[model samples]
Target: MRCEDGHDDAAYVLGALSPAERAAYERHLATCSFCREAVADLSRVPDMLDRLEADEFARWLDPDHAVEPERPRKPQGRVKTFSVRLLSTAASIVLILVLGGGVFAWWWMGQQAPAEPVFGPAVAMSSIESTSPIAATIQLAGSESGTKVRMQCEYSVTAEPYNFKLIAYGPDGEKEQLGSWLARPGAEFSMDGGTRFTQGALARFELVRLDNTKMLVLDVK
Candidate 1:
């Protein structure tokens, strides 16, 4: 009993209409029961189309889809006209799903990937010598951006937490605050740091307490 005259349920379902067309169609829906029911029936189309992954969906949208050959055109009819509108809507849907899938894939990869590459090896920094009651080891690796540093440290003398900084001293009197962390007693912890100076330029690294006392010295030069 509702009007299906000029309203398109598929277009509404696939979000293919222009803004003005959409607003007009929505206004028409308020007075039409048939279009409303049709819209609800087609609402699941989008969810079905989204199952295609980015790569597969992009292949389907590629111009090579026409690589086979073209067929002779037939005379237009009412059914064909409606089908053409549906095909346009389907293209819009494919574009949206392809773009959405690509972005989702990119974001998912960034989440799963490491922020930086694995540094070389852990050097026994405790063997270097210490001026305080701390046990520590250092890892130094070269990177295009800078020198990457990793440390395993423990304040074995007490069970209290103490803040420490990885202070890097360079050959040209360059002092860089590479990184800092809180060292809890008894249990060992790992920390990370970086410096613009390469391993060769780095003269030494010091674990300095908050009051500027050097607890350990790791000579790289």
Candidate 2:
């Protein structure tokens, strides 16, 4: 069976699909790289949900209770099945929350967990130096899996039509090409990129032209 547009990934990760459908998708995942990657990415949702405290899960499951302890009692017998159903419903709700927004929401929620901080606070990059008449700033924020980058650029006509790329150097001396976009002359542009470097792992970020000329470099301190 072929994977159809990765729609089964969400349902499969949430265990919402029928057994037959799940089996078919598993077979498809064996041969389809796209569906395999989708399943791998969506599989993180359960791990994120696991980080929530038992009381937090209880509150999510039963928000009406005002004075609940951290460790809630386990459901017994038939109530266990009911609890499973409740958790399944909660998973559906979460899937709906992330369906349009993408898996980033799941990781973002984990990082913004209430009990404790999963990542350090946001850090702003140093001012950039460019040869052309361009103004840009890059901000790196911590996430559960890595660092998230937000880049904004205001370019003069001199820099128009240039293919620009963002590269990040991690603390371990690993380099990653985050993304690339075209910079239209006399226009402002903003793009979002991500790297697999954890907090404090990113050493520097470079904005380079397609011809391999360096435009700007921001060092993380």
Which prediction has the highest TM-score against the true structure? 2
Candidate 2, 144-165: lDDT as tens digits: 5566677888778865477888
- lDDT of predicted model 1: 0.66
TM per prediction: 0.46, 0.49
Error of 2 at 111 (Å): 15
Give lDDT: candidate 2, residue 25.
Answer: 80
lDDT scores of the candidates, listed in order: 0.66, 0.67
The residue-by-residue lDDT of candidate 1 on 61-137, one tens digit each, is 67464353447888778887776556655654654454435754464456655366577766665433334557788
Name the TM-score of candidate 2. Answer: 0.49
- In model 2, what lDDT does residue 98 have? 60
Model 2: pairs clashing at backbone N, Cα or C within 3 Å: 160-185
- Work out candidate 2's RMSD over C-alphas: 10.3
